[model samples]
Target: MNTEQPLKERLKQILNQNGHALSFEEREILLHELIDLHGQAKEGKNNETEQIRQAFLHNLCHVPQSLTHETFSRFFAENIKPADFRALEWEMPEQYFQITEALYLLRSHIETEKVFDYVTELLVHALRSFERNGEYKKMIELLQLVPVPPSAMNQELLSLRAQAHIHETRRVQHFRQLLYKYLFLQALLIFVAFPILFVKAENGAIAKTIEEATDVEMTEERVQYLSYADGLYWSIITAASIGYGDITPVTNIGRIIAAILGSMGVITIGIIAGLILDRITPRNF
Candidate 1:
């Protein structure tokens, strides 16, 4: 609170006055921590807990803005108000916040961390939702709204935070697009692949292969998106061509679809393997 000393001067003093070896990542991490704490302060209520949270928030907020690039929770930190925390229900976990008490050390944490935890939970939920259904449009909007640290602060550092942020942002964008494709492909399995796989049944019932393979449910409203596990399962089932005896397409059209998935599934796995080989091989990632 020294008026004569500007915020930057104070921070420079804190950072440089005690000459410590700090890497660019470390520097950016510290800045992110500071911003997160400050965001904590801005949302404090009038209660005693709020007072403490605000105090910490203020201390961190007063630090000189980073001259180097670092991304932190710019969205919430910049726009946060004291009363925003009160509307926690909107971000609350499925109307059953109490269930998560066991997961997060709610009782021991500073009130600010509790809020941070809340934000983290919401984030995971949103990401998982997007991952499941390839709900591309909504997912992208939420991605933009994520509370990443700003990349503009801290000009003097081993590595510019901006570059790191860009890398991360690009990575996320790529996955989002890729996941979207996979989701579409999952649904497309029925519409595109099945029509080609159906074989005529002697009982006048079109048997996929003289086998009692389950019919895959091809509902327009119901979209089945695979997860990391599901994708793995898909690979296993598709690679081995051993239907799980569950979740199959039954109609002649469905059979055709399965046939397509079965064949594509083999090459798909190979393509993934090639990519993995390429990455460790060099630039695969």
Candidate 2:
């Protein structure tokens, strides 16, 4: 019996039957009217009125087959005001996503160059959101979606894309450099410590070639000097996984150190290889 019920049903029927017949301007006007009606009906929790508003909004957002670039530009200018695209305090509004989606749909229907400024502005706005949230990866992915802009157009898009890649590459490179330094320092420390450990081993840590060659053990001084030299050489070769067999570890402690050095060598080499590949490989995006 309610008048609002009949009005809501009538609006829904009009949208369902004659929606495509209406021009964008007329549809936009209807959408605004439905929004007001929906607000009033919200107090009464009228689901039917909400459905009608949504239907009208859906129709408004879509581009018609007969739509022309000029009419689209005019309608876009009038209905999609610049003020509506302004950044919100917390999150972007639903309208922002809707407008972007509409713009994407309009790409086939209209010359994007005509709306280049608006498209760029929207992209910048979206990027600012990601930047504020520290979502660099998402920013890169979003930039990838856009085709490379022609040089004749504003260079802002190209600049933004380049800057994002540069920033990401620098960040990755900094981390890799830090990791490389840490590994190098660790290897250096182990190299320095090897002689000390070898000198203290109860049994000679390395093969006693000088003692064995003469069939008379070398003097303590000679043994000590050779121990230091052998320790330095062995550490380098073992850590590099290039055991030349000219120097070798004989004791348990020496073998344990060899294992550790070998593992570290593999890891270090992997990191270096990754760095080289990253430098040489062309990034797809």
Candidate 3:
């Protein structure tokens, strides 16, 4: 049985509901209606295009799926006139325009088995739109959809793919750098807190124990006990939640500060791990 015939009939029912020829605007509207209907019936609503160009793609998707690959190849190859496209370019929304241009490329590729100048132009435009919109993932997917044309166009495709990759890498690095900055700030907080707590602490057993362990002198007066370098080293150990027991605080305020630093260390570690996993994870194209 011909699946396309039934699908075309469904589309015609939608298009002919008003009993009019397909106007440019009505074509767009009816296409959206079809997409919504199709989503309800067949595919899920997980696609970004479902969010961005819900009406056009849904209807366009049906057109391609209705026919066999060969039929689709031939249909576009024979029917899309350059003059018609030139005219459509002036009127169609950019989302529609990009899809149409991609169709044209597919059609041309089917006929000649090589890349055309038009395909190059279409890719460049698509890349710019995707990059501007922060759609690096979409760009990666689109690049894959783009059939490798001739040897000349292969390089262009590779270059665009590389550009998308570079953008993604930079984004991951930025996130990692941000995580590192937070960790540094938290460590600095611990560094500053250690000395202050040491000075404020009474000359109790805990103070004397820390002094002996760290090989430093803790005075009852509000004076520095540990050097700045030692303070920072101790801060790192505390932030790591290691609790080496060599420089523990006996005062209530010191214990409270230690608790806060431990919590912060856990959160910072979690964020850094998540970011690293995101960078390493394979993205679905």
Candidate 4:
């Protein structure tokens, strides 16, 4: 009887079978058996070891089964090479893609942060691959699959996210609408600040610092308290981050308010500038 041939054939058949119906324990058992077989084969023949590895990966890719965290931890420990980490920086190998896809499918079943970090790193590389191919929508879709930790996000991921948003906005023809929203927010901040400043000025919180420059003597009736128009103008200038120094805040509360407004204005301007650059930049790059 050709027992070895039959065993090899049966293993191949199991590899071809979909393991989605199998429980985690069942999958773990099968995985352990395969690893043992591969390890035994590795002792005498390199070709058999390679063949078994390829079959194992092929089976892993096709099966949507979830394995236990310990199984995955062991699997990665045995399989992951230094080359696998290097591949993330350059062209991603097809094997890596398959592995990442398989892990992504079982993301919800993952319990350990270590296993999840592996999945996240792989997916980030996959996202970069999509970005290189100008597949922004696909990149965005893949990103939405996992809840990537904020700590793992580098500048590369942030750039990918921005590109995805720009591509989506361009596709949906909502660029103008987005611009309008930003402008509305800016205007809203200005108007909201206006009311607060007007109230402060009404309480004698604001004063004109250049009273002598205007050759006006300070008096009870002739005191140049900031007017409503001046307060609104100050709010506009403060939000624009263009402090002209024509008016000044006398109270500590008023200075604090101005400082906050100035910081917000700078951030808003930066956002607007980034939006404009994104709109004007060519997509071909």
Per residue, candidate 4 scores C-alpha lDDT tens digits across 1-285 of 755675577567666553346655565566666676675553566555555555454444333243324565455456643224422322333444556555654445554575566665666666776777776766656655544577877786778777777786675456657778878876876777554665464454343433456766433322235666777788888778658887766555566777877888888889778877665443331
How would the candidate models be sorted by lDDT, starting from the highest?
A: 4, 2, 3, 1
lDDT of 4 at 111: 44
Better of 1 and 4 by lDDT: 4
Better of 2 and 4 by TM-score: 2
The stretch of ten residues in a row with the least summed lDDT in candidate 3 is 84-93
- Which candidate would rank higher by lDDT, 2 or 4? 4
Better of 1 and 3 by lDDT: 3
Kindly provide the TM-score of model 3 when superposed on the true structure, using C-alpha atoms.
0.45
Residues 1-285, candidate 2: write the lDDT tens digits: 577776667666665654357766666566555555554564566555545434543554443321234544344444343333333221333434455666655666456774565666767666666667776666666666655457533565566667778877876777667767876797765578765565444145344554577677644432223466677777677667746887655565556766777787778788778866774343555
Collision pairs in model 4: none
Q: Highest TM-score: which candidate?
A: 2
User: What is the TM-score of candidate 2?
Assistant: 0.50
Put down candidate 3 lDDT per residue, 120-203, tens digits, no spaces. 545665665576667786776665566554564656466776788787677767776776787677666776865455445423
Model number with the top lDDT: 4
lDDT of each: 0.41, 0.57, 0.53, 0.59
- Give the poorly placed runs of model 2, Cα more than 4 Å off: 1-104, 107-111, 114-118, 140-173, 176-180, 202-226, 279-285
TM-score of each: 0.23, 0.50, 0.45, 0.39
- Residue 71 in model 1: lDDT: 39
